[model samples]
Target: MRLGTRGPHNPSYVWRSLQSTKELIKKGARKRIGSGCQTKIWGDPWLPDQVNPCIESVCSQGLESSTVSSLRSAVDGSWDIDIIQDLFSERDQRLILSIPLSRQECDDNWMWANERFGVYSVKSGYNLQTNVSDTSPNSPSINWKFVWRLGIPAKVRNFIWRVLSSCLPTMQAFLTLRVEVNNCCPICHNLPEDDFHALVSCPWARSVWNISSIGSYFNSSCTFADWWINITHRRNQNDVELATAILWCLWQNRNDVVWNGKCKSATAIFDSAQTLYSQWKMTRKLHSPQINTEQQTMQERWIKPPE
Candidate 1:
C-alpha cells in the first residue's frame, strides 16, 4: 500500500509512524500477481513467501537487466527460460521457475504473508508486534547485556535490575498496589519505604553510603534513578562495578532489617561490598583466558550506552 508523507505540524510522530509501518510492510507483505507486469525480478519482493523479505538472492554489484515480466511470454503466462538463465544464478533461476502463475486472471495485490488466508486484521498486526517484542529469536534488548553479563550471580544481577528499574517490592510499591502494608520505612520509620527511602534516603541506608567511598557522590540533587544513570555513565569501569556492588549490598542489608530486624552496620555493609568485588576480581584471575592476569584487570568491562 502507498503511504502518505509526514504532516508539517508533527513531523517526528508522522515520520516515525510511517517508518515503522514501512518496516511492518517489509516484514509482512507478499505479492499475489495475475500478471508479472508490476514486480521487479531484482529489487522487489515478488518471490515465494517463505523468506521474510521474499527476495531470496542478493546481487550486491546489481543484477543484470531483468524484470519479472521479462521471465514470462506476453501471450501465455509461461516461463521464458532464456532471459532467466542469462540474468540469474542457477539457484535463483530454479527458485523462480518453481513459482506457479495465477490462473484466476486477477490484478496484482498485496496481502499479509504472516496471516492465515493472506488476510490482515488488527489482531494480526498486534500479534506481529508482540512476536517482535517477546517471541522472536533476535528480539532481546541490547540494554539487557549490561545487566546479564555482570560478573555476579544471575539472581544478584536480576535483583540489581529490579532496584534500578524500581520494580522491587518496596513498601511504597505495595501501598501503590493497594495491598495492606505499613508505609513508613521498616528500618528507620522516618519516611515512606519507597525505592529511594529503602535504598538511599533512610537513616540506615544513608549511614551505609556515608561509610562507602561513593559517599562523596551522595548529594542533594539526586533521585535514585538520577544517581543510577550517573553511576552507569562514568568512564571508569571500577566505579560502575563498585556502585553496583554497593547498591546490591545496601539492598540486601535493608532486606535483612525489614525481614529479621537484624542487619549489618554501615561499616559492615561497605566491607561486604568490598569483599564481593574482590572475590569477583580474584575469580576472574583464576579463570583468566589471557596469559597475563594484570592485562585482563586493565581491560574495560562495562558495556554502557553512549551518553
Candidate 2:
C-alpha cells in the first residue's frame, strides 16, 4: 500500500491492498479470464495508501480527481509488454504506438478501447507481452469498480445526484414532453428543473423544511446547494451524514407521491429522517467506543518523512 518499491512486479500486493479482503477479491475474480487481480493492480496508480502522493502529482498537472484516477488505472501496467501487445493486438500496437496520444487524449482512447477490447482482454494483452498472463490466475475489475475507483469518492456529490434524481417529479414519471420543452420547478413553475428548487426554494419544499427544527438553523430562503456546501465543508462527519439522511427521507416522500398517488407530508418526512439520524448516531456511539480515540490516534500518526 506504500509507494511503489524496487522489486519484482508483485501483483498480489496491489490486489490485496486495493481490495483489502481475500474473500471479496476471490469472489470478484472467480470466473474472469487471465490473472484478473493483476489487471486491477496495474490499473490503479495510487494504492489505498498512495492517495495523497498521487493527489500531489495530479494537482500539479491540473488533472481533476475523477479524470486522474481513471487515467492512472488505465496505464499503470502498460510497461508489461504482453498485456500491451494483447491490448494493441498486432494491428492496434502498430496503430496506437505509431500515433501515441498525449495523456489527455489517452483518456478518451482508453474509454473507447475498454468498450471495444474489454478491460480483461486489454489487461491480458498487456500481461502476455510481459509473459505474466494467468501467472497468478485470479480476478478482473468490473466497470462499476473502475467507475468508483477512478471517479470522485466525495459522498456529497453522490448524495446530491441521488436526491435530485429521486425527488424530481419530472424525471420520476413517464409523462412524455416535447423535444424543446424544459423540465421546470413544480411549485413555482418558472425556473429550470433542479434539486435546489425541489429541496430548497419551492414553496412545498420550504414548507416541509420550515416545519422541522432543522429549518430554524439556517436562513429561510437558502438554496439547496448552499446548504449542502456549508454542511459538507464543516468539520463534522456526523453532521454531514445526518444531512444526507435527511435528504434521503425528503426524497422518499417525493417518491411516495409519484408511486402511490398519495399526498405528501413534510412533517412525517422530517420526523422520520430526524429520528433515523438520532438513532444512527446513538448506535454508533454505543458500538464504536474507539471512534473518537481512533480519530485522535490518526491525527497523531501523520508525520512527514525526511525529504
Candidate 3:
C-alpha cells in the first residue's frame, strides 16, 4: 500500500491489516509483564520458549477475564509460582517461571518474543511473515551462506540470491505481475521463461552446464531452487565456483539475447564462466591471506523491504 498524507488511515485497509497481524501474534509473541494490566493472563503470550517467544494456552477452564497481574506479586512485581502452578500445566509453569520480571514500574507491553530483546521492531515483524522454518539445517539462508562463502565475487553471489528469490526480470515474473509480457523464454523460446527455464532448462543453459565443472550433476528437468541448494550446500569448492559462474554467465547471455540480439554458443558460455571463476580465485588469493569462513559475513546481503 502506498503511503498517503500522514493524517487519517483508510479504515478498510487498516482493519484487514490488523486481522492478519492478530493471526501472527497468535502463533508467536511474548508478553513481558510490567503492571500486567493490558494483557489477558490466559490469552496473550505470557510464557517463554526457546524456539518461540510466546506460548498459547488452550485450557480455558474458567480464567477468561483474569489478568496476568492476578498471578504475580502486586507489591514487589514478581511472578507468584504457586498461582502459575495452580492454573497451568507443569510445562507451562516452568516456562512462565523462567521469564525474568522487570523491576521498573511501567505499563504492560506486548513484546516480539522471537527477537533478542523483547522490544518490537519492523525487522521482527517482517520475519514473522516468512514461511521458511529455521528449524531445518537445509534452510534457504543457511545454504545461501555456503554460496556466499565460496571464493566468487560478492556481486555474483548477490545475483544468485536474487535469481533464487525470483527477483530477476525473467519473462514469467513479468507475466505473473500482469506486466503484459510474453511468457516464452527470452533466450530459447523453447519453454516458458522462469528462473529454472532461463538458467537451467533452456537449450543453451543445458549446453553451458554440460561441459562445466558441474557437468551432468543436474539435468534440465531439475527445479532451479532444488538444484541450486544441492550445488551450493553439497558440492565442493571448485564445483560451487563453477556452478555459480555458469549461472551468472547464463543470465548475462540471456540479457544479451534480450537486449543486444547476441546469442553465444554453449562453449562460449563455459569459457566465460571459467574466466570469471579464475579471476575471483586469483583476486582472493592476492588480497586476503586467510579466509573468513564464519557463517556471518561482511558481504552485504539483500533483504526485501516490508510490504
Candidate 4:
C-alpha cells in the first residue's frame, strides 16, 4: 500500500494500526529497478546504496515528475550519460551509473533492503526496529568489524555487541533509561552495574579472569570497548576465542544470578568456558572438508612408474 494514501474518514482500528507500520516498511523497503518505467527518479527508493537508497540530488525545475526511464536512452535502453551528468550531482551520477540495467524487459519490483536475498524476515525487521530505536547518547565507539569477525557463535557475538553498545540490561543501563531498579552490581553489591563493572571490574568477574589463561594479558582500559580492543590486538586468535567464550559464560552466570539466584564459582565458570570453546572447535573440525591423506601419501610414493 502507498504510504502517502489517506485512510477512510472513520478508519477501523486495524486499518489505523496497519497504517502506523507504513513508516517502518518505508524504512526497510526499496524499489528494485528493472524496466525503470514506473519508478520515480527523485522520490522512489531505487538507488543501490545501503545507507541512503533514495537519490539525494535536488530535482531540476521540470524534473520533479520525471520517471527513471526519462534518464535512459530510448534506443539502447541504457542510461544516457550526458543527461545523467547534467541532471544529477556527481555522487548521484556515480550511483546511478553503477546500477546495471537488465537487458531483458521486466517490471520494476519491491524488495526488503535489510536482507541480502531482498526478502523480508521477522528477524531482520526486529533488528532494524531495535537499531532505529537505539539512539542512546552513551553508546560507545566500538570496532564493529572486529566484533562481527570474532570466530565465535553468532549469539555470543551479539551479546558482546550489546555489552559494548551499552544496550545490555545492566542495572546502571536501566538507571540511564529512567527505569527504576536497584543500580547496585548483583555480583559485587558494591558498585553500580554497568558494562565495564559487570563484565570487567566485578569481584566475581575479576576472579574468573584471574584464573583464566588470558588474565595476564588484560589491559587497563577505562571503557569496555577500549579494553576489548587491547585484548583482541595483543592476543592470538585461539586466545581471543577462549577469552570470548569465557566472557560469554561469565555473562550467562551473571544473568543466572540475576534471574534465578544461582551463581557458579569462578573456577566452574572458567571450566565451562573451556568446555564450550573445545566443543565449538570440535564441531567446526567435524563440518570442515576432510582430505584423503592415504591417497595423497600413495600418490607421493608413485614416482611415475615407467609406463
Candidate 5:
C-alpha cells in the first residue's frame, strides 16, 4: 500500500491497469493517526487539510526520520505545543495542533480522505478525476454562464465550452496525451495547433474572422478562453452568437483540412457561419410557441365556467 512499492518485472495486463491507479490512491489516501508511531510526520500524508494533506514545513536537521509520536507529550499523549512551535512553521504548527488524537491506544491506518467513513468508493474516485480535470492550474478561467447562455445551438455551445476548457483534440492536445502526430497547424502549417492557434491564430481562421462582423473584438489575448470572455463582455448577445457560429464553422473547416485535405475560402467560411446563425434564429422563431393575445384573453375570461 506504500507509494514506493514497485510492480513485478513482468506484470500482467490487469496488474498494469491496477498499477495505473496508484496515483489516484496516493492522492486520496491519508494516514489516520492512532498512536502516531507508524506515521512519519515529514513523509506521511496525515494532515486533515484537503489542499495539502502532507506537512509543508522543511524538516529540521535531526528531524528527517522523526515520527508523529515525537511531537506528542509522553505523559498526556497530546501534541507538544512547545516542540511544534519551535520545530515547524506557524502554518504547520497550527495544522499539527488541529488534528485530534485518539483517547485509547491504536495502530495507525490509511483512510480515504474524500469520504466521511474513511472508505474509498468508485464514485469518489470519479468525482476526484472530474474536479482535477476541470480545475487544472494550466486551464484558464472561463465564463461558463456566457458560453451556455449564448443564442447558439446546444452542440455549438458545447463545442465552445470544449475549446474554452482545453478539451478539444488539437495537435498539441494529442502531443500532451503522448500520441505521435505532427503538432503543426493542419490549415496554416505554422504554429503548434493548440486551442488558441487552431481557433483564432491560424491564418485560415484569422482570414475568416477578419472578414466577419465581430472581427473588431479580437485582440492580443493569449488564449481562446480569454478572447471569448473579453469579446462577450464587451459585445452584445447577437455579436456573441455570430462569433460563436463563426468559430464553430472555422473549426469544421480546420477538420476538413486535417481529415479530408480540403480547405474553403475565407468568404465561404464566413458565409457558412452567417447561414448557420440565421437558420438557427429562424428555426427558433418558427418553433417557439406564440401566444395569441385575443384567444388568451377569451380563455382567461371564460376560465372555470363548470369546474
Candidate 6:
C-alpha cells in the first residue's frame, strides 16, 4: 500500500484538510514537488503552531517543555524526586510538577525532566547545575603581564588597572588611602587626594575630560606616565596635538580646581592649552640666542612632537 493512503472504507478528510491548509498558505505548489510544509522543515525546533515574540513567555514555556523532554531520556531508576525538589527553587519545581504524568509515563517524564531540567545526575554523568568549584575548561584566564603593559605609573597603575578590570572590589581602597577629608574636592566629597579626587571622580575633572574630544580615549588603566610615553611616541601631528591638548587640559584643570575653585569647561581647557603651548613655543624660539645650543636643543627635543 502507498504511505499515508486511506482505506476505501474511510473518507480522505484529513489529507484533504492538510492540502487546503497548504493552498491557503501558498505552499500547495511547493508541496506538489515533495517539499514538507511544516515550520520544523527549516530546522527550527522551537517554532510553535503560532510564533510569539514576547521573550519572557517563550523562555518560560520553552524551558518547561525542554525540561520534560530531558527527564524522559534519563531512564535509570536512580532518578531522585527528593533531590530534584531540593535542587530547583520552589517556583521552578512547581512548573515541573505541573506536567501531567501516568504510571508508565512517570519513568519517561522523570528521565526527561532530569535530563532536561535535572540539576544533578551521577548515572548519566550529566550535571546540569554547577557552582564556582566546577568551571568550564574554556573559561578565560587573566594575563597579569598584558595588563601591566599599559605602562601606567607603578603605584597608581596597580590599583587603577585592577579597578578597570573589575579585579578590585571597591575604589575606596585606593581613595581613602589617598584623599584628605578636610580638603576633599568640592564636587565629589568622597575623597580629597591628588590622584583619586583629581583624575577619577571630581566633578570639575569629569566635566573637563568630558568636553575634551580626547577624553573618550582615556581608560582608568591609563596613567600620567602612560599619557606622557604614548604622546612622546605618537608619529602623527594631529594625534600628538590631540594627546597634548588632553594632558594639558587635565593638568590645567586640576590646578584651576585646586587653586581657584574654578571649573573650566572642556572646550575652554582645550582652547587655552593650545593657545598657551603655541605662545610657549614661539617664546622659546625668540629666546634661543640667549641660551647655549645644547640647552636650546634639549628644550626643543623635549617639547617637539615625535616624528
Q: TM per model?
A: 0.48, 0.37, 0.67, 0.54, 0.67, 0.29
Candidate 3 per-residue lDDT over residues 239-282, each given as its tens digit: 87788888899989899999999999899989988898888888
lDDT of each: 0.69, 0.43, 0.72, 0.83, 0.84, 0.41
Q: What's the CA RMSD of model 6 in angstroms?
A: 25.6
* Candidate 5 stretches greater than 4 Å from native: 1-38, 48-53, 56-58, 69-86, 104-141, 176-178, 216-221, 282-307
Q: Write the per-residue lDDT of candidate 2 for residues 1-307, one digit (tens) a residue.
A: 3223333454444553454333222222211112223223223322222111111221322323233222223455223445445433354334323332233322221111222332435454333322321233432211223223322225533655554323234531212322234466444566655566556666666777677544523465554545654555552555555556666676666556556866456677777867877776676567664646656766445678999
Which digits, one per residue and each the tens of the lDDT, describe model 6 over residues 5-37?
444553364554454333222210111101112
lDDT score, residue 294, model 3? 80
lDDT string, candidate 1, 24-134, tens digits:
666677776557766666666666645533455655355444556667876666888886776667668777788888755556677787788989877787556556655
Q: What range of 10 consecutive residues in model 3 has the weakest lDDT sum?
A: 1-10
Error of 3 at 79 (Å): 3.4
User: Ten-residue segment with the worst summed lDDT in candidate 1?
Assistant: 135-144
lDDT of 2 at 265: 68
Please, what are the lDDT tens digits per residue for candidate 5 over residues 107-183? 99999988889999998996776576558886655666666677778899889878865789999988866577999
Q: How much does candidate 5 score in TM-score?
A: 0.67
Displacement of the residue 185 alpha carbon in candidate 3, Å: 2.2
lDDT of 1 at 222: 58
